[model samples]
Target: MKCFVAVLIIVTLATDAVSEASVRTCEPIKVAMCKNIGYNQTGMPNLARHTLQADADVTLQTFSPLVQYGCSSQLDLFLCTVYVPMCTDKVALPIGPCRGLCESVYERCYPVLSEFGFQWPAELDCSLFPAENNHEHMCMEGPGERTAPVGTVTLDSVNAGGRSACRRLIKPNSWVWVRGSSRCAQFCEAEVLWESGERRAAEVWLATWAALSFACTLAAVGAQLACGDRGSAGERALVLVALCRCAAAAGWGVRAAAGRTAAGCAKDSTTPTRMLLAHDGLANPNCAVVFLLLYYFGLAASVWWVVVAGAWRASVLRPSVTTSGTGTRNDRHSSLLQLAAWGVPAALAAAVLVTRDVDADELTGTCFVGNQSSKSLLALVIVPEAICLLLGTVFLATGLRAILRRPVPVPAPTALLTSPPQQITDQTLLRLGAFAALYAVPSTCILATWVYEYAWREDWLAAPVPTEIPSTQPRPAFWVFLFRIFASQILGVMVAVWIATPRLKALWRKIAGPRKPPLTKCPAGPPPTPLTLHCYATHSHSLSRSQMHKYATYRPPQQHSYRKPRHYHYSAGETIL
Candidate 1:
């Protein structure tokens, strides 16, 4: 019995030793391929008992045809040929078949090897296989290979011959794989259709908002113009602002319309490219130029006009300042404002044209500076506008503080009694407050969006496939989209509402037509007294005697005495005598 026990122990030890040796001797590529398919190395001992070399040799021989068609290595050939065909049964192509085959191969090979006193290894690395190599070519390996069904469609087919359809369908960073040419084609078509619809929707949204903004700005400008020179300096500055907003809105609308028909440049579907150069070739450079120039000019002018308006209000609100030299000061200030509003933008646009390329992009949905040229835009346009907005905000805050801090006159009691109390209206301050708040909305939105884009610069420039399709995007992306849309498209309308005033409304009424004033009649009164003859003669130094005599016949009414008689004392004295 002791000898039998000792023999059993020796036999078990030998089996373990043999399993370890066999596993160690297995080719690294075969082990990797097996693991890549799905065989865990923990069960590799079972696989080790199956003569791994012989099995790999046979698998290679069976799929040798794939190597001739540019398969990168033996593992690549095996994945494309032996594993994919065996597990799929030639039905629909399996998703990530190489991975599926790995799992399937391990399951089938494990049980057979376990019968021989071996188990699969647990520590083998399977990720070394070049799964990214084009697998579509392997589909043509055998003589009776299947083809896509008739009436099936494919996308990006123009460059389909160069790269694997599977690789194209599954992005490099992504790991999910779809199966079958028909299904893959359908998936791709769905994505394409969704992207096209999103683009069209974005265009329509931008155009519609832009048109509304343009109309509102026009109304604001008309109201200001109708006021003529009677309007306040701040109101006049607002006219320029409205004009700028109108131009900006019109430019955005034009951009949206032009982008639909403009096919700038064809992108290389195979190789990765920079976002700026990827779409720089403009078919309609003229339209691009118009939109970009107008957009920058209008944007800059709008901000500066706000500054001008704020400054005007600040000056008007100062107590020590008189209205005597206001006309002269306004003339000078207006000239400077005109120069800054129009000239600064022109110079910036010209600089951009000279030093950088202008291009349209999905971000703005309009022609503007290109991605590589974005720094210039930041320096010339964005930075200046931000600074102006900041300064405008400060001025507005100061103006508001001044308005709030202004002392309200306490009427003296006697003064109130002697004169009617005058009504005091803080209309100017209220208007200023409204303008400040309205201007801040778009400016703040713009600044916030800029920060968001800068922080996520890689996400923006990565140019992800079907980038505009919102369904697959994360939550933050949607917020960014909303921010951009609201900031860029609603400024004019908000400004219009901000500047709408009673004076503006009255001006509009006058432009519509004047109304007639109601007629006022005098009230009836007592008749005048006739002159007396005696009085006329006494004062008639220039009157003739005949005229006096003619008037003397007129009699005057007699006067009656109201006093009592004083005869009591005299009557008493007479009676005593």
Candidate 2:
């Protein structure tokens, strides 16, 4: 019995010693403002998350202006407890403010940060601290924390997190910090980070518009098909362009329709609390599918746009062997056009896949390359997009110049006009202009929006950190996202408009209106046997003697009757299916 008690006593003493010695670097609070508040000893890596005492003092010093402004009476204790957490023999883990205390201070002080174009610092995330002082999760629940009078700070209608913070604040099912980023930024998997209906509405809008775009592209392709080979070289190339648009719109439509599911979102390799898309191409199966459709097909559509413009320029500059289709040059360019439209995007997509540039865009909930990475955005999107526009623009401008320079053929004044049919009406010119604008305008706008996003990406990745000057917090514009969704799909609808011309309508009617009954050849047969009739002289009652004798064997004078010829037809041996 005595031995058993002695061993038990020794074990208890050992546990107490370990607990007491847990804080090795306990020392006096070096921060000036924090010294006057209750607790004296502090541990390293203060709650402001400064590692060194000197650094902690400096960061806390920056907040002196707000402390002086008196947002909260408890602000001093709150700041010190976090920046210089309580360290003592009584407690092993440093004692930081309770979640309630942290939230209270946050509510008061975030407004001040807002004024200076800042967000609530991630270091002081209230959720990171303990809920209450307890054995397992100990924290400093300040005396009468609930009973303490609240501060005079105004909590405005604006969320204290500000737009950038609010935009990024996702309630993720699972998350990891975006790889290579220092801030607590997460790549969410499975949902969009929307705080209000406005954001949700954007997603719905994209899906609906994309569906419309798909329908429009189908209409354009349908019209082209119905017109058969009658459309010009430019219009023919437009058929291919419309087909590409159909594919891209379908991809985007898939993304919008999926709506906050695993298919559209991706994982960030780095923060647990936050989820952002990491650059891992084809890592998610749905992401891979979307990438091919939007990137490969979208790029293909742009290349085809270049082909459309180039065909127009060729018609004006090279004229044609005949106006029926185009010059021989067009036939020669067909192989090159196919290579450009398909092969180039395929190569680019292969590169993006190997490099894993695919990322899920937050605003649209669509997996695409360059949504979260600036490098990917610049290389994969901005550069290629700009180059496509540049080429198309050059072709369009050259073609316009050619058309304008063509000589006008004034009718001769004698004007009996040895007339041949012509179709150079003002309406035709207007349709051409509208077609060119529709093609170029949406493309240019999309590129411009991409440039803005590329510029805004770095700031977006590192939120709550004020990189910009205090005067402006240039948050990534919500309109940029909305515009991107609209412009990306509007090209397809515009193509439909271009195809809705009177010319195509007439051609459609001619091809699909009514097939005429085909003419057939007359049958080859022996000539009609001569109709043999021996004419006997009419009874000579009224005839003279000589006339009666001469006419005796002469046929009843050949009597002719006028009537339409009987037509005969022979089948060509074609079997209708």
Candidate 3:
């Protein structure tokens, strides 16, 4: 019994000693773990490790059954190898041969871990690796450390031994890593990769609409010009509006084409990955400038043209106003309207060009006045457009109301007899109101959507993380964007339809040809009437009145005696004796 007790005590001591030794060795292993992942004395691996570990724990704790189980199995092996001296030392044997093996292990493990929402601690981040050796491998920097150049590091020149070592530990193509020099670059690349079929469909839709709008606007402009002297001031203003729409649509089409090229390049798997890394694939500055100029000009011009049309309509409707003898006034108004419609937008665009950095993207491939964050875009572009649209709408509404409510003059009874009374039907009022509403709808929709998006930015930003590969655009934003595209692009078509009125059609016909008057013929029954006979009396000498009377009396007496006997009657057409 004494011998057995002694044997048990000895076994207990041996087990305790082994555990103590392991505990002591794990301290160094922890420190070496940081170093193996490229952390140095300057790097606060403990802090990064703690923070990342907490995040990982939260992620794992909240994970679904399948993910939790799969991750648990993988992490068990990883944690065991990390904590145990024997396992760690076996992997790091012959440090030179194991260098690549260590890197390969980290590379292969990180993506799998990330898939489970486990971000490796910053200390283990390849970006934190020493700058001197950045070309040798991917690295992460310590907090406040100077950032190393990204994409400068490549594995192309790695020695055969290193490749062999890495291959022995990690399967071929098991992990592919890309390092960008800047976070912006990485974000840009991720955005390109994250682009889905929906966005592509949206682009195609926008492009098609833009093309149609361009054609329609061009046709409207031509038709309006063809009206020449017959076109009303309102029609002329609409022509300007249509021309602006054409310019804007053309710009959009061109911009979309550029974006399509970039998207095509991105979608091509055969394209070199290095080429895709640059910003050129996203936008071109030169093309952006042209697009922005045309787009903003058109946008501003359209708003101001509405203002001009409203004002002109109001002038024409006012009882006190007469267009007669107002040629100078009309010309001045036109000049001012032209200045406002074209000049203000030009000035604003110039200001944007000078004050802001314009950029283009696959989403809005025009050189718009802001970057991806769109920090000043609302203020610069959308706000002015909104204000103009609002003002124009107010002007339109006021003018239309004034025109509608104005008392029609009662015709005098005599005037009514001479000409029929001019009718103002309910249908005419309804049509006018509908036309005004149609003009306002597109701008109003655009402004409303923009406001909604702007106000709801926080909600959009705070939306819950998606379980699957997240979409680059939120569903709400995508729908809103699609709506805006449709509204803006369809304006030209609406205007074209609106201008196809009977009056314009009549004017077109008149311009084509003028009518001829009917031919007349004279009557044919006037040959029997010889109303007067011309007789020539020649006298050799002039006689006094008494002598002429005596001669007449004598001749008359002789003729009377003869005529009494004969009693001859002469027709009124013949000369009497």
Top candidate, metric lDDT: 2
Worst 10 residues of 3 by lDDT: 89-98
Cα lDDT of model 3 by residue, 1-577, tens digit: 9999999999998786465344421123333222353322221112123323334334333323322222122232233222221212222110111223334445545654565466665433433323332434222221221222432222221221222222222122221221211112212233431255665777788889989988887877766666654343555566667777788887777667666444322221112222232222224455554446455756665665565546555653553544463445656687787777777787777676564334444354444553222444577667777777777677667767776787877878776654532243234334444655577788788778767756654333332334787654333457777898899878777776665554468576787787778877767886574444322324445556675455444343454342222123334476522
Please give the lDDT score at residue 395 for candidate 3: 68
TM-score of 1: 0.50
* TM-score, per-candidate, Cα-based: 0.50, 0.55, 0.51
- Using TM-score as the measure, which candidate wins? 2
- Across 363-399, the per-residue lDDT of candidate 2 in tens digits comes to 5557787775666788888898899899989988887
Instruction: Estimate candidate 2's alpha-carbon lDDT, on a 0 to 1 scale.
Output: 0.67
The models' CA-based lDDT, in order, is: 0.49, 0.67, 0.49
Worst 10 residues of 2 by lDDT: 152-161
Compare candidates 1 and 2 on TM-score and give the better one: 2
Off by over 4 Å in 3: 1-195, 262-286, 361-367, 414-434, 457-474, 500-504, 507-577
Name the runs in model 2 displaced over 4 angstroms: 1-175, 178-185, 189-196, 267-278, 412-421, 424-430, 464-472, 501-504, 507-577
What does candidate 1's lDDT look like per residue over 525-544, in tens digits? 95444432213122324546
